[model samples]
Target chain A: MSEEQDIKKIMHVMRRAPHGSIYTYEGLEMILIMAAYEQDLSVAFIGDGIYALKKDQDTAGIGIKGFSKTFMALDGYDVEKLYVDRQSLEERGLTEDDLVVDVEVMDASEIGRLMNEQDVVIHH
Target chain B: MNIGILLKEGPYNHQAADTAFKFAEAAIAKGHKVDAIFLYNDGVINATRLGDPPQDDRNIAARWTELSLKHGVEVLACIAASKRRGINDEVMIEGGEITGLGTLTDIAIRNDRLLTFGD
Candidate 1:
């Protein structure tokens, strides 16, 4: 497990909506697993990915399993670095207060800069 | 430097395969080693040799094959994802291979960078 000892900055970019596709949910599963390795991890919510953390999501209506609350469990996994795109939120008419998890609201440029610094960037 | 590529979407239906090919090409052009290209989910279709596009269109599967054939890049599709999508070795492109997720983890561990391309 010497290879596991090497820490890398891994950022999982979520750009798709939940339920409509499995990207967001699967992306969360990835983050949770990577977190166990204790690498420097961050999750970015951009485009429709912003909806993944929206509050009061009732998937019961859609007859699909809802895991919106899973975002909250990320903190316990030590993967607390979550970033939300400011422009994406505005385009979707949502605010920081509307999400289920507390996140650092950042501009696209800021996220892009951080993305450049990562050893891995997993886009979903 | 060694680099790993993770492609998560299929060809034609999305621009992910094109972008990933372009990125891999550029990386190799810059003298960086593209250690591997791991296909997951719908991305597994990119490795299928059965893809036959119109004469006027660019062939995504062929493009990946060219990358591997020319640059020695290992184009791999996840066995789990490939099986679910009916992508077995028989249908794999000349330079493509069906591999397990553990290989992806090894690629991540050994590479200097692991970049992802998707829709």
Candidate 2:
């Protein structure tokens, strides 16, 4: 068996704008399932993806359910390894307290290192 | 490199596809195996065979084709999404396939990991 044959780490990049974006919820759900089935899976929020992690996602006037709740559901699936770009959060004035789910804070430089470390890197 | 790139953006746009290409190149450079590249939504246009960019600009459409041909990369355009964009296999020049959500389902089931790139 070769190195590639053995599954290691999986990274999900969620960069889509939050309001009225299906990718935000759908993308998070996708990786959450992968992590549930696989042990070494991880997730990263980058660019506009960080918007998905906003502490309170208001979807009422938009006529949809808030997706931040989905982030909390990750625990049920055992999607424990989570990450978010500190700069992205800061640029948007979103502190860790603003995230619906708890996650490790990472800078772009740290994210660069993490991507290289992963066996599979999925950027949504 | 079993890269599952879910491009939700178009070819002419300066978004998902271009950024995805960079990641694909980086994966190859780092000796990763991208077994599959899946395009959903507007991404199906990547294989349109009629995306005629300006002569001086790099042919993004052809670049994708070359990537698959030159390397052993598997480029799959989602059938459902393709129909939405009118990018069916009938419009392909050659060696392109129209797939479905099941294709992405299979990649998630079979590959070591699935990564998605969207706009």
Separate clash counts for every candidate: 0, 13
What residue pairs are clashing in model 1? none
Which of the numbered candidates is closest to the native, going by highest TM-score? Answer: 1
Off by over 4 Å in 2: A1-5, A20-22, A36-39, B1-6, B11-35, B45-75, B78-119
lDDT of 1 by residue, A1-124 (tens): 5575587787889898888987787677667766777678899999999999999999988899999899999999988899999999999999999999999999999999999898778887
The fraction of reference interface contacts (C-alpha pairs within 8 A across chains A and B) present in each candidate is 0.29, 0.24
Indicate the residue-level lDDT of B59 in model 1.
Answer: 87
Which residue window of length 10 is worst by lDDT in model 2 chain A?
A1-10
**All models, DockQ values?**
0.34, 0.22
- For DockQ, the strongest prediction is 1
Grade the docking of candidate 1: acceptable
* TM-score of each candidate structure, all chains considered together: 0.77, 0.62
